[model samples]
Target chain A: MTIVEQPKASGTTGGAAPRGALDAAALRADFPILDQEVNGHRLVYLDSASTSQKPNVVIDAVSAYYREYNANVHRGIYTIGEKATAEYEGARARVARFINAPDSHEIVFTRNATEAINLVAYSWGRANIDRGDAIVLTEMEHHANLVPWQLLVQEKDGDLEFVPISDDGLLRLEVFEVLLHLKPKLVAFTHVSNTLGTINPVRQIADMAHAAGALVLVDGAQAVPHVPVDIEALGVDFYAFSGHKMLAPMGSGALWARRELLEAMPPFLAGGEMIREVHLRRSDWNDIPWKFEAGTPAVGDAIGLGVAADYLTALGMDAVRAHERELVAYALEALPRAVPDIAVYGPMDLDLRGGVIPFNLPDIHPHDVAQILDRYGIAVRAGHHCTMPLHERLDLAATARASFSVFSTNADIDALAAGLVEVERIFRG
Target chain B: MDDLYRDYILEHYRRPHNFGVLDDATTSHEGSNPLCGDRITMQLGIRDGKVAEVAFTGRGCAISQASASLLTDEVKGMSVEAAAAYRADELLDLLGIDISPARLKCAMLSLETLDAALADLDASASPAAVAAEEPA
Candidate 1:
């Protein structure tokens, strides 16, 4: 039975599926790549924060797209063409439904979340923001969120301000309120920190930004895969996320924006399929999303992403979130005990964070820790995790991050704990 | 078989050699690996066309710190010209460990810093200064 159709357990936080609700091993079985051995040991993948392993269904969906309905979208009137077009647009619609976007046309597929963020910063920022206007962001944002705004701020000669994170790694909302006093033209931030895994209160921040007459754009790349996100409920102007992080193919992501906002912004990329009437030099832009989606999209990847969404929906996001939370909770407690002097970053409160744990061992560089763990067939991401600014704020050069997905189990955490002991033995012994 | 953090490498990381600022440095340069945030400030006292003294101070991964420790030891008595021409492979040879491509930058940051220090010394001291001071 599909996980959503399974009897919903009514007890966890927000009625999140209990730890035992979703069978971890069964779900792990869904991902063919996770079953293999690495370095003569069972591959315990803790790098989902980087990119998730694809499930059989998602892999087959992409293969099936090229195998069967291989045609360009939106122009084919023939059977396979119509089928391809239907599938492509149907993927967009599925993304829209996944995020609870009011309209499917509001979702525009891009290469990845970085491209999605860049699309808004260029198309919307150029049109609306004037030179020297205040554009506020947080110190905790991934470089994707930071660099795009840096480019925009430079182009517009805009004043950029950052909302700093507190010692506990949560956003200083009061400080964000203080920055709103700048009456900023835009407030862009991440929904969850890629490094700290702190779940920013999107709705609260959106309310504050709206009160101060500013538009909010959230980098939902880390949020969409692990959390139950309803873009409507988040009440933000723009939401961006990647397909690769959520059991989908790489090369496919989406941008969800307010219909009116997308209607107003200029097209980001101009080419065929995004235009209505082409003259010698100029052409009328296509509709809300199509106008922005210039050239041919990654049709096969999009179909795979759509199936991935179905896979997640079938498993239910609440169960996914709950499953990861259980793993994180277990790791948070187990890691420090397993290896002394191990410092874990991000919130300790279960409700306040996602499954990411950026950490360090005394006198041990994250790179060394990761290298040692590799021998034990444990895959944890090390380094600044594309959040150099966040690392700077934390006074850390780099950190080893152990992030969890739905399929991660207590056994995986145990393996991580055991692997870390070996790192200590090699380095500290 | 490719055990990266061997005992000696870890020992170098734990108790790195000449890991302090040189107040008498003739030239100094700081090099960094932006990917891993490994920074090394290498200082050298150039005299009689030789590296009379060398020291480094920075924070980084074990690979980088240990590599710097080994590099400082290797270049302390080497001529300025030879130190400037210190190749990446030479440093890898001293490491005596197979550094995967990902950690190569970490392993090479030392040589990069030492080279930068020598370059800075060459630019500021001028070629004649080293030759003129060689007899003294």
Candidate 2:
């Protein structure tokens, strides 16, 4: 019962012409998964916030790395090993440039953004944070950014405070100031809320935290894929993001920190390649970045992430931002109009949000909504989105979220709206 | 109507039967599907070795809520042992729909909670006898 038909092209404002700087129709072709059909309908993937579909270039890059020159990096003297090493290090350089970090040596490869935050919490928090110090977080942080700090503060006998979010889902700056008055040792927050899509003022927060004698760690897992992030310009000590959220393969992510901080922090894990000299009972750790990256890394996936970075650079992040904004604008207007009694979470202003839209219909559970949408071949995320505290704050058990990417189009939004109508008919009729 | 969300499913979901706590409950148990945030607290009133009343309170999707409704109706007059031995397939057959593997937990949550309540009864009757029945 597969219906291989072209997507509907006559339903929305962006249907007749390209809405933003990027031509979404042309860009959507690059993702082969978008061309297929599911359950007698064209697949409309609105779950990019969970993980983006890889482009052909990223797929080819990873395949070519394995098929052409596959070898262990940093140890072998053969040509293949040297090539692999170059590609692996080249990825770190590309990621460093992508975030405009001061030095490539500041970038450390990690499993994902969660692991990156854990690395900072363990290697940096244990070294500097004392028993009486405090660590401040935000109510909107995902578990990846929240749990590690909670565990760290618990272990160090320090206090953990959260800056509450307002009714509009924006962080209350006054409350943040009050928390800052506690003279915290470190302040960690998400650059964009994965559940609410609220974009925080990163540079301003970083400045305030620095003035309060605290280091800043920004979880850019939801920001780096949709917006231009200059880590040095933002004046943050550490910025972490995952590659899978940005059209790259999983098992590849980077944590960008100041070179001096990386130099001072102990190695997160002890194994080969992270040590300069080993003895029976003691060992001298390696230099910056490699000191954090112990044992063999995901070389092929890193190269694929480099290609993904190159692809985004080639497309220009400003254009990507513009495209997603238009899609979100269309969604914010279209979803509520199509389905009655819909409640949307997060800031209503377009400037304050990213591509993620979390919402719920009256008396309809999010899982049921997602299941109904799935029948139409429309994919969406439904749950607490790993922000249970925020969901509790909002008085909701869960929400249905539709996050956009560069390949998303107005027709996809139309399908989502139309699917909600079906959901309404099924439940309310 | 969709096969999974049939008319009866929606009706039961909108106005679930026996959807509250039993004040004189003899056995009670709670279960949760953490992945989807579906939760159920099932309570039973037993008299003369038979199930006298059944009630459940929770929030979840249509399948879970309606399945809970159907379970309470089916178990109201049954004995404790019969309710404990009830299989999951019977509930699915009673629902008259095919549930995807991803949603199997939602459909089986009520049964699991009911099983837990029966297990609690078994545990409280004679702790040493139940402990000795275990194969070490």
Candidate 3:
């Protein structure tokens, strides 16, 4: 609470207009990329789960860093150098506050969430895990969350256990406890499934993992953009997320580990920065987050990410969430009506899922469906969507997915339904 | 519409030609675009140095299925050696549309399957050790 600063919203009192109330139609203007056409129709960009369209503020902020203040951080005593270092550290502080992190030093900048997980696997796993250790992962994790631990487990000759997912894409918590009984060294899983849209109980899982003496790491790439997250409240040791998926530039992502854990771990990469003193054979590492950040970082991207955090903060994550929850519920009902015999995968209850929805038209492959939808200028994702294990678990070859964001509306859902109707007419006629 | 050849693509997808498994396949191989899970199993029956029978059985997109459906007619009575030597671009050009670079693999899946089947035939005719080098 010491670091948190927000104007208390009196929306519930029915007096003042809701603070940070998200007006998606009006908010759409903030994102310049959304006001465009594709294939002679309005671009119904539904692939925000892949990467969010950048807002004007974020884009301008990124360019401003290069145009106004361009210098290497922590090196020169010149004005621009000092400004660059200040902006970079300022961005780090904003990111820290965004996730309710107690200290900015806990956040380590990486290329994306994938690299963040790889950092933990390479640095912390190498230090902590040994041969014959047990690691538990879920069946529905994106490859980013799954593969790094896999490399570590494979290297260590450790046992890797998967908490299986049900046919509807929900994690079987009973199986998770059974795997936990094995006394795994770590439990690495996604906060939300990219394909299935299943939102796992992170706090509960973290509590269970900690009780069993296992460290917990969450892949919050899908979760952070659409939902409100407090890593401290979740009680997870490590939280990884991407800036690109949250309306920032592509090269910005971060890892937020507990301060003590970061202090104890080794540097992920060795280079010009991230060092206290370097001799020919041996070099003393720098401080916590800087120790993990190796080279000249993506300073411009970090600036963009900071602006994006501010953008989301203004819109209010709770309102953004409420907007999506209503939009997705409408999509689930509206899609089946638009196209007969359409099948959607994930929990039916909106409480158990996020805005991402993966679906299929009967007998028509996901690629063909996506291709036809592309004609209508509706960009939806098709194929395995980097959740091959989850697809395999559900015995599905592929699915066509449309994920919503703050700018999404019921009209987008209607347009998607209409586009799907076109898909059905072409493939089913 | 939209300048794409979706009409004919849908036609072949709806009523794909020679889509049943061949009863007497001399060479058989399964090929898949692992990225999209587009699998095609091509079978050929060669007699008197010509392809006496040709068929395929699998599931995938309209382009992949239609591409295979169209190619079954092209190689039905051709010499087995000539069919085995079919070039990828020839098959692609025969599709009668501008295939995007992303979907070139879907349009050429049948040819790759044919090449794999021929490679399997080559390995079968040689020593057992040749089978060890087969593609995963």
TM-score of each: 0.95, 0.93, 0.95
Candidate 1, residue A339: lDDT: 88
| Model 3 ranges off by over 4 Å | A1-20, B1-5, B127-136
Fnat of candidate 1: 0.85
Please give the lDDT score for candidate 3.
0.86
Native-structure RMSD, model 1 = 3.8
Pairs with backbone N, CA or C atoms under 3 Å apart (clashes), candidate 1: none
Task: Score candidate 2 by TM-score against the native.
Answer: 0.93
- After superposition, the stretches of candidate 2 with alpha carbons farther than 4 Å from their true spots are A1-20, B123-136
Q: How many residue pairs clash in model 2?
A: 0
Q: Write model 2 residue lDDT over A101-169, tens digit each, in one string.
A: 768899999989999999999999999888989999999999999888888878889898999999889
Winning model by DockQ: 1
Ranking by lDDT: 2, 1, 3
Better of 1 and 3 by DockQ: 1
Model 2: CAPRI class: medium
Instruction: Superpose all Cα atoms of candidate 2 onto the true structure and report the RMSD in Å to 1 decimal.
Output: 6.1
DockQ (Cα-based) per candidate?
Answer: 0.72, 0.50, 0.71
Better of 2 and 3 by DockQ: 3
- lDDT digits (tens) for residues A372-424 of candidate 3: 88888899999999989888888888999999998898888999999988878
Clash number by candidate, in order: 0, 0, 0
lDDT of 1 at A100: 73
Candidate rank order under DockQ: 1, 3, 2
